[model samples]
Target: MINTKKIWYLLAAMAVILITTVALMSNKKEVEKTPKNPYQAIDGAKTNSYEPVGESLELTTDDNVIGNKKAELIVFVYEDYSSPYSAVLAETLSRINSELDNKLTIAIRPFVTAGNNISREGALTLMCAQDEGKFSEMRNVILAAAKEGSLQEGGFNVYANQLGIDETAFNNCLTNEEKSLKLEAIMAEADKNLVIGAPTIFIANEMIIGARPYSDFVDSNGDAVEGLKAVVDRQLSAVGTKK
Candidate 1:
C-alpha cells in the first residue's frame, strides 16, 4: 500500500511539471508569432533616405513678373543643371507660363541633386548671374546651353561673351569668395527644405516630386470666377470676424 501511494504521488508531480513546461513553450510561441504594424515597417524601411542641399532659401516670385501678386497658387521648382528631368521641366515650365498668361508664377531654386561637382558649378554660375543683374538672361542661356550640351565649348569666357555679359567682370564674380559663400548659403537652404530629388516642384504647399505631367499645371477645375469669388468672400469673412 505504501509503495503504491508513493508511485501515485510521483506520477502526479511528473504530470504537473510536464503541463507547466508546455504552457511556457506555448506562451513563447504566441509572443514570437505576433504581427507588427505595416506602416511602422514601411517607416523603418525608409529611415535611410535624405534631402538635397540648398532647400532652405525662401523662394519668391517678387523678382519675377509672370504671376499675380495675390495669386493663391505659387509653384516652386528645385532644379539641377546635370539633371535631364530638370532641363525638360524647365522648358515645359516656360511653355506653361506663356500659355497661362501670368496666371501662374514659377519660382526656381537651384540645387545640386545629381552629384557634388555639377551641382556646385551650376549653383555658382547662377549666383554669378544674379550678382551681375543678369540672372534671368544668364539662367536662360545656361539652360539652353545645357540642353544643347555646349556649356564647356566656350568655357566661362565664351559663354559670358555670348550672353553679352562682361567677361572680366563675370570671371571676377565667379571667383569671388563672397559670391561663393552666397551660393553655399543657397545650397544650405535647399538642404534644410528636405529636397531629396531634382525637379521637385511645390505648387502652393503641395509637394510634387520629380518631373510631373503638364496636366498638373492646369487651372482650377472650378469656374475661374467662382474661385475668385470664394477667395474674396473668405478674406471679407476673416475681416468681419476679427475682434
Candidate 2:
C-alpha cells in the first residue's frame, strides 16, 4: 500500500539526473584544462628549432646568390645553420649545384625558431661578413664550428679576423634593430611561401621538402637528382632558346 510503482519511477528519475550531472561535470573539467606545451608562434612550430643554410647568407647585399643569377634555374632554401638535416640538405644541394656546374642560382634566407640566441647572432655576423665581402669564408668556418659546437662562442669574431673583416665595425653593427626586422621579413616570406619546416627548397613550381639522400631516398618526383636535373636542363634549354 506504499505505492511501489511511484517509488520506482521516482528512483529512476533520480538516477538519470545523477548520470547527466556527472557527464556535464566531466566535460566542464576537460574544457577548462590547458595543454602542457603552451607555446604560441605564428606557424605554431616548436621553439628551439635550428638548421643550416645559404648558398651562404650575404647580409651586405640584398642580392645573395649562390650561382649564375641570369641562369634559368633558381633554388631557394629556408634553413637554420644549426640543423643537422639542414646541413644534409645543404650538402645535397651544393653537390647538385656543382654537378650542374653552378647553373642554379641558390638563395638562402633566415627562418628562425624562438629561443635560439646563436642563430640570431650568427645571422648578424653573416650580415657583417657580407658587408666585408667575406660571406663565403666566414659562413663556412662559422657553420663548421657551429655544426661541431656553438655559434655564440665568440668564434665568429675569430673567423672575421681571419677573413680580414673590420673587427670594430662588425662588432658595433651586431646590435642593430634593423637586423631583427630583416629576420622577421625572412620568416614572413617563408610563411607566405608555405614553408612550415626547415630545409624547404623550390625549383620552378616544384617543391622539395627536407633532405634527399642520393641513393636510398625517393619522393613523388621519381629520382631526386635525375628528375631535378631533367627539370633544370629543360628550363636551361628553354632559357637559352629565348635568349
Best by lDDT: 2
Estimated TM-score per prediction? 0.59, 0.66
TM-score of 1: 0.59
Measured with C-alpha atoms, the lDDT of residue 116 in candidate 2 is 75
Model 2 misplaced regions, further than 4 Å: 1-61, 153-155, 216-243
Query: Model 1 segments beyond 4 Å from truth?
Result: 1-70, 216-243
lDDT of 1 by residue, 5-50 (tens): 8999999999999999999999999999986521111121122212
Evaluate model 1: give its lDDT.
0.59
> Which consecutive 10 residues in model 2 have the weakest lDDT in total?
40-49
Predicted structure with the largest TM-score when compared to the true one: 2
lDDT of 1 at 47: 24
How does model 2 fare in lDDT? 0.64
